[model samples]
Target: MAAVAPARRRKRRSVPIGRMLLLGFFLVFVLWPLYWMFNTSIKPSDDYLTVPPVWFPTEPTLVHYKAALFAYRGLDGLINSLIISLSATVLSALLGTLMAYSLARYNTGGQHLSFWVLSQRFLPPIGIVLPVFLIYRGVGLYDTHIGLIIAYTVFT
Candidate 1:
């Protein structure tokens, strides 16, 4: 008599328990800090610096956000920050794109250019901050949005 053939087993489509645990831990690590920041931002001034701190606000409030956006002290600073940040971002993208095109198309050897760009990142910001501050003072552009844009462009 012929023997019957056994059926083939399909592979299981599941992650290993170890991987799942690692992923869960990583997600909690990343998200918990952000959640804490938002939580603190929404908490009342009285509860902000308490011992152990509150994970979730007992009486959630929008006062901090409202003050940040609409109040006299907050709104002015926010506007100034937004203007400077947006200006810098736009300028950097434009300049970097042009620089990238030049670097890509030109047959300048890779190592030197790479070193040049990498070197910029190593220079301590504190070392140059004072000279920049002095220049801005001389130009009468200190504390101004345009001055900030110029400074950021030069540094980046």
Candidate 2:
């Protein structure tokens, strides 16, 4: 029998060291701020304003968290945010479904009407802010939960 020829090995391509170094530098630059924020939160107040920044806290404390949730009423604000967001989401979904169904089944207002309605979404919030604020104020809904829910639902 004839001797089999030796099998050839494939050469694997290697990544450039310079490109890897550049990507690593960008990764650190983007993540450094997030790391600093977390580090600062856990650090003692005295270490916050030190000339040389504290990379690691010797004694981590939860006093800031406790103060935010209790003393500053952060818990109440969180609850209010949840309520407003949920209410607005539900209302918007319900109204949008009804409108879409009507448009599809009945072709309410003609073919262009759907386009007109969708165009409203592209309008900048800044343009309507003053008008909505004025209307809310005039209707005595300013600073109320219901008003915020309505505003969010409409904008969304």
Candidate 3:
């Protein structure tokens, strides 16, 4: 039997210099805001409005974090957010599953109804904001956790 020849390896293509530069520029542009946010968060309040801006804080502190999580009720806000999100998600999932099952099994409202329901997702929230607000006010669901959950469930 003849010995098998080794397979030739393919050469890797190199990225163009101009493309690399453009990618680097966009990377810096996107990451600069994140870096600034983190830097500012750790910096003292006095350093915030400096004319030249502080790129790196000489003395970083966790005072802001402490205040937000404790004094400013940030923890409560976070808990409320979690509650609202979980409730809305569970409700939406349950309702969506039931609707989908009915549509699949019974073909209720025919094909057009499913399409129409899906098309609602593409509708901009801004368009219905006024109507929703009025309805919520009328029903006295305004400024409540249940209200938020209901709104999120419907929108989502």
Candidate 4:
């Protein structure tokens, strides 16, 4: 036996003026700040603050980046943040994988657990920060990189 397919009508293609205008407006709106930030960032110190405002950086330099990590003593803080972030990311990936497997294959915790996890996301971080801060301090986890990593893992 053979089957016949039904005939289909082609879609009419036309760009609406309103949508095009909206797209153009959003493009400029989003990109203008990014363009201005880069334009200002590359300017030399002398040109960074000029009488007439040198918009194009006559003598561009990478000093701003150097100053951020060196002059402001941010290198240690940056390294600590990186360690915490990476640890949290790795732990989250492992736990998330196991949780997903259990939920999909074994239906662990049932729908109630899933609902509870989903609901936790709706609660603002500010609500829990105070209690968490006190508990972490008492347990000697406060101000340590491990504390930060554990906190990051829990948030997600």
Measured by TM-score, the strongest candidate is 2
Which is the better candidate, 1 or 2, if ranked by lDDT? 2
Candidate 1 stretches greater than 4 Å from native? 1-10, 40-59, 100-123
- Candidate 3 worst ten-residue window by lDDT: 102-111
Give model 1's TM-score versus the native structure.
Answer: 0.61
Assess every candidate by TM-score: 0.61, 0.80, 0.78, 0.71
Candidate 4 clashing pairs, residues 3+ apart or interchain: none
* Residue ranges of candidate 3 with Cα displaced over 4 Å: 2-6, 109-112, 115-135
Listing every candidate in turn, what is its Cα RMSD in Å to the true structure after a full C-alpha superposition? Answer: 5.6, 3.9, 2.8, 4.9
lDDT of 1 at 137: 97
The count of backbone overlaps in candidate 3 is 0
Instruction: For model 1, name the residue pairs that clash.
Output: none
lDDT of 4: 0.87
Query: For every model in order, what is the number of clashing pairs?
Result: 0, 0, 0, 0
Q: What is the lDDT of residue 39 in candidate 3?
A: 95
Better of 1 and 2 by TM-score: 2
C-alpha lDDT (0 to 100) for residue 64 of candidate 4:
88
- Per residue, candidate 3 scores C-alpha lDDT tens digits across 74-152 of 9999999999999999999999999989988896886799999999989899999999999999999999999999999
lDDT of 4 at 12: 92
lDDT per residue, candidate 1, 54-116, as tens digits?
877899999888877787588788788889988999999998898888787895766599579
Name the 10 consecutive residues with the lowest summed lDDT in model 1.
106-115
